[model samples]
Target: MKKIVYAGLFTFFVSVISFTARAESTVGYFGFEPDIITNYIGPSSKKMGYVRVTIDLMLTDTSDIAVVEHHTPLLRDALVEILSKEPEEKIKSLTGREEIRAKCAE
Candidate 1:
């Protein structure tokens, strides 16, 4: 009985550790969500006007959607760089929305 209990306990611990070792990042793990600015808020928003952008980002192994709250700037920067010169037409339009989603998925 004692040997059986020890064997079962050992198996449980090993399985638990193995499960943790196999985690994978989901599409939402890009660390941040895209932000669309429709209006400025003085010095806080600077001279930037309302614009839409799609951000495609690489995800860190441990990142998730929740981390987006902390990485908003990163997402905006990436989107701006990739989708520059057409923020208004690209982000606000229906086609742009689809493009944004496609880019983000990749």
Candidate 2:
């Protein structure tokens, strides 16, 4: 009985440690501060509307946080460039939003 109990406890501890390690390796998220705001073209060529978006980047590893922080300016610029060119109609639709998300993911 003592040997059985010891073996079970050892297995549990090993499992717990491996689980913790795997959890640590899971994806990490970094959200842009103050959000991203950009202008999109409205129905009238002379008029433009602004859209505000909160962007979050999913990093393959938590250690990549610093790398993302370093390139935040470039990322923000790319997002703004994408959003600014979209029409107001597309910007407000659900499917269009998903399309924009897909573009961002690329």
- How many Å off is the CA of 87 in candidate 2? 0.5
| Runs in model 2 lying further than 4 Å from the true structure | 1-22
Cα-based TM-score, every candidate: 0.32, 0.78
lDDT of each: 0.57, 0.92
The predictions' CA RMSDs to the true structure, in order, are 9.8, 3.6
The worst-scoring run of ten residues by lDDT in candidate 2 lies at 19-28
Winning model by TM-score = 2
- Report the C-alpha displacement of residue 47, candidate 1, in angstroms: 12
lDDT of 1 by residue, 1-106 (tens): 9999999999999998888776542434352343544442233435555554333455553455557657677666555555544455565669887886777555
lDDT assessment of candidate 1:
0.57
Candidate 1 ranges with C-alpha deviation above 4 Å? 1-48, 52-76
